[model samples]
Target: MNRLRILLADDHPVVLAGIRALVEAEPDMEVIATAADGTAAFDLADRLRPDVAVLDMSMPGPNGAEVAERIARYCAQCRVVMLTVHEDRAYVRRLLEVGVAGYVLKRSAPAELVRAIRAVAAGGLHLDPAVAALAICRDPPRPAAPEAAAEPTEREAEVLRLTAAGHGNKAIAQALGIAVKTVEAHKANGMGKLGFRSRVELVRYAASRGWLGSLQP
Candidate 1:
């Protein structure tokens, strides 16, 4: 079997070492590279195009959300999983709105990180369980009270959810077990149906409809 390629990004050397150790300990996984900041993370990821990028949420330059977006645009096959200490639902919500794959809290155990990586690599979403619960219960009113009903097909909804979670066309296709062209079709159809002309609007629509909750991240 091919080893899972991984890229680590964190400003702290100690944390970076810990993550490298955790990932390298897994026989099926390999640490391909490490970046000390978000900019370098983006550069290395664009160059190496690892299977997954374990990024710090509060990194310098673009931050996690922006980095995830860049990865989706430039390295569509590579998935991004945020590793951070933040439990802020809004922050998580915002990142998911941009289609990020996983969100693991820094407090989570190393095993949990491994679990998250595997889950996402398998085309499933994985949120830190605590974060999921908090997001679900903390502010029920936010997602529960959608102002409009932007009708979308089942496949379109799926595309929207995955897109909002930061999966690119190729990743979405893999996750949905469909062709990349089909993923693009669904994304286009969904956006057209929602009357959304931009990814930002699509994200807002998905967030209002609570589609982000249904994703793994």
Candidate 2:
């Protein structure tokens, strides 16, 4: 039986050990390698090519964000999960833009980290809900296509609402009793029709439309 192999990186020794223990305790996950800085993390990742790399975002040298960027480009097969104390919307959005598959705050429970590692290893986006709830972000403006940006179908709205509320695609799929692909397609179509570029933007849009029940300003 194949288990999920992980490369863990953090500058702090105690934090590194704690996270390593948490991951090792899980039956399905194993920590294959560990690194103390971003440069070492990048080097270890290149050598190990683990299923997932949980990187501390503020590590020294190249830094976790830079390491994530490199891993995404050079080790496309290995998923990058940014483990950080940063819950800033800008930082989270920037990490996602750089292709990190998961963004988890250090203050969050250890179980959340496990969930994020598993989710990204299986090719899914995983975000901490507290960070995700701060949905406003700035992006370069694109020309609005009003025709293409028409009102979404009922199903699309449903998907967008759940998505805005911080539900992963798989979770939304299960809730709606639809395939994950279907959930993704609806989300894409809805975002296209609404001129939304990111999940946070989609959440704000959904809130504006009253599709999401209580996510307010």
Candidate 2 backbone collisions, by pair:
none
Native-to-model Cα distance after best TM-score fit, residue 95 in candidate 2, in Å: 0.5
Local accuracy of candidate 1 as per-residue lDDT tens digits, 80-108: 89998898777777766565678899998
Give each model's clash number: 7, 0
> Lowest summed-lDDT stretch of 10 residues in model 2?
135-144
**Which 10-residue window of candidate 1 scores lowest in summed lDDT?**
139-148
Q: Write the per-residue lDDT of candidate 2 for residues 1-217, one digit (tens) a residue.
A: 6899999999999999999999999999899999999999999888888989999998989988899888866776678888888877789767765667678888998898998888777655677767755543244334346777478899998887766544556657777899989998998998898777776566446555665443233
TM-score of each: 0.75, 0.68
Cα lDDT, all candidates: 0.78, 0.77
Q: Candidate 2: TM-score?
A: 0.68
